[model samples]
Target: MTLSSSDSASLPAERLGGLLQSASFHPQQTIALGISDLAEQAKEDRADKLGISCAEEVGSVYAAILGAIVHRDAGLAD
Candidate 1:
């Protein structure tokens, strides 16, 4: 789930912060998978609310963002 600079560029700081906060409520291993699932759900919710078809793309971006956050929190990132 490592993201290139470009891949991470479009992630909103506020959204990432919200995900981080949500992840904090779970254990480390669970947080990783949970964030991914949460991101997918968020993507679907946003797409439905906005009448957009970009859920897949949004989910991918959020997955990368959340993965980076989880890896860093687990002290697995350099």
Candidate 2:
């Protein structure tokens, strides 16, 4: 799910999330320990990501995704 310089304004959040989910970054590892532990869904996946030490890349990846989502949702990317 790669995007070129153009046509990026139309990318959807859910679609992007699906792509990100397949990446090396993992949400559970980046999130705080207590919070990650409390999350019931994807707990095992999260733990696995943590075990693999993917936490460092998660925040930046999430922020970029959020920025894109916000831009599209607000019609500001145009």
Candidate 3:
């Protein structure tokens, strides 16, 4: 998934890997829902911190994480 400028600015590089790894422990549907919640939180955080909407950034992050999860599951199913 593409990282928006705001996402790169807000989320540290190292933390991204950790977030993905931790999320893998959960079910896909649960992970998707959690990502939605996280995106909303990120949007709120970015708006509060930078006074700008970060919908695109958060959406990018959401898609990236979901993609990773799906890819991982597909690999495991093979």
Candidate 4:
């Protein structure tokens, strides 16, 4: 499943994981690791407004989608 920017935001974490895992775009572990990195970034950036946990969840998803864009732009995936 190739992800496009328009629809990436709507994908659930599990679904995104499945797509990344099944496609083997880059490395599954690398993508998985982004969850924590993204969550931390989100918490740092949005915790004041959205609260810690909520911002983490939002940040994780946003980061994952952004990562996908990076991968695509880098020609890591078709």
Q: Considering every candidate listed, which one attains the maximal TM-score? A: 4
Task: Between candidates 1 and 2, name the one with more favorable TM-score.
Answer: 1
Worst 10 residues of 2 by lDDT: 29-38
Evaluation by TM-score, superior candidate among 2 and 4: 4
Q: Highest lDDT, which number?
A: 4
Each prediction's TM-score versus the true structure: 0.32, 0.30, 0.31, 0.34
Clashing pairs in 1: none
User: Compared with the true structure, what per-residue lDDT tens digits does model 3 show for residues 1-78?
Assistant: 444578646665565555556655754654465457678878988778764346667888999999889989889534
The CA lDDT of each predicted structure is 0.69, 0.58, 0.66, 0.70
Evaluated at residue 51, the lDDT of candidate 3 is 43
Q: Residue 38 CA error for candidate 1 (Å)?
A: 38
Deviation from native of the Cα of residue 7 in model 2, angstroms: 61
Cα lDDT tens digits, model 2, 1-78, are: 344546334445554445446444654443333234335536887788786676667777998999999999999987
Error of 3 at 29 (Å): 0.9
Evaluate residue 59 in candidate 1 and report its C-alpha lDDT on the 0 to 100 scale: 88
How many collisions between residues are there in candidate 1?
0
- Write candidate 4's Cα lDDT for 6-74 as tens digits: 755865677666656755655555555555556676687775766767878999999999999999999
- Candidate 2 stretches with Cα past 4 Å from truth are 1-53
Give the 10-residue window scoring lowest on summed lDDT in candidate 1: 1-10
Better of 2 and 3 by TM-score: 3
